[model samples]
Target: MAEAPSWFGEVERAAWDRFRAEIPWLTEADRVLVEVASTLRARLATDPAMSVNAIAQLRMCLSAMGATPADRSRVDIPQNDDDPLTCYFN
Candidate 1:
């Protein structure tokens, strides 16, 4: 797994870890998007005063990455028979 950016706070680091865990199919090429999503999640967690638009944008980012159940259902990650967790994609 890629290391979280050094500037990431605890919340961001936690969010990064969760994304990496849940989106195991993500390649190094997806790192930027993951970082963006993690940063947005951390911002949302720490800033209750965030504007509705900002929240919506974060939700969009999460959805694009298949982080939500509905979005995940739309994704077709290939299953690796040797990896039990991959079976979840099937």
Candidate 2:
């Protein structure tokens, strides 16, 4: 286990709040999702080159937290691109 990133707590919480506020239909518990996402993100930051399968698994966890591809909610994804990715609201 490694230390949680200094930015993760703030970034994750902000995303969670925005998601819940916008979707209002994510019946999944907040703590659970955040914890899971934190683990994946920490892993990503440490060694993003981790197996494609592993990366996909983490992606699945993240995708599960939001809407489908059609609904885009503007968000700051930090590292994916220079700009923040738009998260679609399900």
Evaluated with TM-score, which candidate comes out highest? 1
Per-residue alpha-carbon lDDT of candidate 2 for residues 1-90, written as tens digits (9 for 90 to 100): 223335556655555555455445555444566556656655666675778887787667666665445333543322333344445421
Give me the overall lDDT of model 2. 0.54
- Model 2 misplaced stretches (Cα beyond 4 Å): 1-28, 67-90
- Candidate 1 structure quality by residue, lDDT tens digits, 1-90: 578889888999999998888887777778888888888888888998988988888888888888789999988886758977775875
Candidate 2 to truth, TM: 0.43
Sliding window of 10 residues with minimal summed lDDT for model 1: 78-87
